[model samples]
Target chain A: MTAAVEIAGITKRFGEVVAVDNIDLQIDDGEFFAMLGPSGCGKTTTLRMIAGLEFPTEGSLKIFGNEVGTLPPNKRPVNTVFQNYALFPHMSVRDNVSFGLRMQGTTKSEANRRAGELIELVQLTGLESRKPGQLSGGQQQRVALARALVNKPKVLLLDEPLGALDLKLRQEMQNELKSLQRELGVSFVFVTHDQEEALTMSDRIAVMDKGKLLQVGTAEELYERPLNRFVADFIGQTNLLDATVADDDMIVLGNGTKIKAPNPHSPGTKVAMSLRPEAIEIGRRGDVPADHVATSLNGVVSAMNYLGHSLVYQVKIDWIDLEVRTDPVASEDRLGPGDDVSIWWDRTADWVVPDE
Target chain B: MSGVITPRGASRTLLSINSLLVFLFFYAPIILLIIFSFSDNRNVGVWGGFTLDWYGEFADSQPTRKALWNSIQIAVASTIVSVVLGTLGALALERFTFRGKQVFDALLYLPIIIPDVTMAVMMLLFFAELAGVLGLSKGFATITLSHIAFSISFVSVVVRARIAGMDERLEEAAMDLYASRWQAFRYVTLPLIMPGILGGGLLALTLSLDDVVITQFVAGPGWTTLPVFVFGLIRKGVTPLINAVSVVMLLASMALVALSLFVQRVRTTDSA
Candidate 1:
């Protein structure tokens, strides 16, 4: 099957500044894809290009195998839910939802009936006559959603739709949006800066930075194996230690400890090793598991933080510091600051990433 | 308590007296004009018994009635022309950018910033030149054209303010929902800026009605608006009829201004 959207060599420039650099991306049909990045990373711009709100300076954009690079938004088979909801303030909830249908020459009664069903679908019954000004923020969001979804486009582009909501309301809307996409079986190109939101909601995420597509993968793949130093540090918490490749399948840490791991780079090449805090087991010096321990090191516990369900200890090995997270209930030996501890991890838990 | 003389109390009394003087300063002449308009005496200032004779004379005079009709015609025609041109100018300035846009923007404000006498001279010269070439004569058409020339600036200023405060994404959303460019503007942009359009039209009407200097410059024979005719009447003498006409104009202007304020208030409440 053809992809919902196929963007090839897309580049958007505003005068001398490049908003979205040359990048290629594909969103599968019915896939919940997220464009994740920091602010001004061009994720929103890429989404706009697909929605035909902004034409790419140089590229070909196809939706279901049709070239629509320079086509106006009205001619495209896609819709967008803007960040600010952008509901027509003078229009009632029903009228706002039915505006697209009316523009398509639907009869007034027929449009009203369809809009009423959509309003009910968004759980906004009994608000047919109320203007957007009279609705709360969440209600307005639902109206915006219904307005775009009423068109029944092949793909829906959402630009940080939940960024304005409070934390609890945002979480609620995230779950709702995920389920909505699932039930409708439409491709959703969600643009957001929140890593957790992208990881939790998107089936596949494209991480962008500085107008560049850094990585695109499933959540587990991105978490387990980040391609570079930036992706490793951005996706989640990790202790990135500067190391030199000692040989093939081995690397040496700063403190001269050699560890057996898969290394694609030649010897003497500098790299960064990503080790998750939860992957490291901390205990007394002789408590290493014989089968699981690929390497072990002795360190002094500099600080300890109680995180209710888990305990995080800052372990200092020579001049390098590593954070080790431990389950409070599972471990009987409680470690405190100034205690000597040994930390070990399995070989698969550590991966080498490029120093960029 | 009555005997106590606090500094705050003294200042409060002074402030109240100051406010009373200010109110009297503004409304005293208007109040006197209304009272004298009803006087039975021929002299405007004389304290004669109340009568509606001047109002009856104002209504009966054929010249006054003709001038009033002329004023209404000019005001209505000028307002319609100015609202269309001015709204288009405002949309262009606010929504697009091109070469020489700064120059165009600055020139839009020239009519508003220039003195009335200068604008009158400018229009007079313009029509004089046009007449020499195109055989255009100064009459109802010339007067209406001049009124529109000045009133366009005011309408555009008001409309531009409304456009500036609007959220442009609403138009984008309309187009994203399958509305063509013209349809988006007709449905989304026009309804949103309607209050400003109405306000601008009423303001143009008031300006055209109140104009005397420019109309006197461009008006030909028998094309005298009410304000110009009133100014001509003042040169001969101030009569109770003139006072009645002035009061009538004042009431009409106040009503238009009140309607403009009402429309603006509705816009604010709708957005809120």
Candidate 2:
């Protein structure tokens, strides 16, 4: 399928600050794509540029198959649901939904009829005559969504649409949005600072930081095989340790502990290893299962937290804080602070992340 | 705790007394004027039996009628001009950034702060200086122009505040929904700022109708406004006719202020 939105070498500069550095990205047709980043990481800026609200300083942007670099927002074949759900205060829900049609010179009756259908589609039928302020936050968000979707643009851009909702409501809306995009079969480019929301909804995710695209892949791919230190640390909780390559399948940590890893670097080459906390097993040195213990490090528990279903232990070994999470049921002994313990993980669990 | 009033209770009482005093200070004179306008006797401030003779006399007097018409014409003209200029000024200041913005903002407030007598003198001198070059003379045009000069500032201040409170994202939302630049402003921004525009226009009308000092300096020959004519009447000594006219002017201004407030409330509720 042809790409719905293709951005090539787009760069946006505001005086001296480079808001969006040169970047190339594409959204496949009917794909649910997400741009994930921290605040001020240029994710929102990239979305705005594709929506034609911000002009790119360099490079070209195409929507579907048309070059839309210089086109104004009104001329673009895209609609955006803003982060604040910017509903028109002065218009009724029906009028707000019909606004795009009216602007397109559709007859009043036809516009109203189509808007009525859309309102019902968004499940807002009884409150059509009410203004925006008369509705709750969720209702207002639904109206914003209905208003944008009524135009039936080829692509829909959402800038943190669920950011304002509570956790439960956000989860509910995330599912609804995913189903809605699936039903419409239109490309959706969602921008959010939320890692879980992106992972739960997107077909593919783009990790960005400091005006740079770090990596892009499926949720599992990015989590399991992060390309750099930033992506490795950002996707999920992990313990990063400074290390140097020892041999073909081994690396030495700063604390002089040798660990088995698939090191692709030359011997003595400095590297950073990312070990997921959940991947590590914690127990007394000889109590652990022999087959499960690929590499074991003896340590004393500095702190331990009982988290209902699991226990998290912060093991101190030569000034390194190695976090190990173990299911409470699996570990027969109750570990506490100041207790001697051992941490072990499989050889395949430690992945080498790029240092720079 | 048993003997002392709570801070909230004490503040409430103080606020009530202060509000009462303010109401009396502002409404006492207007109430007296309305009551005296209905008095049978011609002597001022002393109430006789109820009568409608002064109103009848006011309706029959040609000079007062002409002066009222002239006041209405000038106030309407100046208010229209002021509304346009003020709305533009508010949009310019609120929607764009440029050099000397702070200086321009300070200048917008200057007309409101300068003494009316000084403004009148300044306007007189300005028109006098331009008379030879532009054939500008003191008449209906001069009075209307001077009223507009001060009214624009009031309008801009009110409208600028309204615009500042508004979210610019509303316009961007409109554009995102396929509205052009003009359509976005016309549908979203204009309706949002309408209350401020109406308020400023009514204030301009009230100020122009109530103006006496500026009118005295700028109004020539028979182009006397109601307030200027009334000031001339007061100098000769207060009359029943003067009280009647003053009551009418008060009612007119009150009606305007009431209308503006009503419109504002309706707009707010509609949006809300």
Candidate with best lDDT = 1
* Best by the TM-score measure: 1
Which portions of model 1 show Cα errors greater than 4 Å? A252-259, A266-270, A285-298, A329-332, B1-15, B261-272
The all-Cα superposition gives candidate 1 an RMSD in Å to the true structure of: 3.5
In candidate 2, which residue pairs clash? none
Best by DockQ: 2
Q: How many clashes in each structure?
A: 0, 0
> What is residue A11's positional error in candidate 2, in angstroms?
1.5
lDDT, model 2, position B144: 95
Alpha-carbon lDDT, every model = 0.91, 0.89
Query: What DockQ does each candidate score versus the true complex, computed on alpha carbons?
Result: 0.63, 0.72
Q: After superposition, how far is residue B182 of candidate 2 from its true place, in Å?
A: 1.0
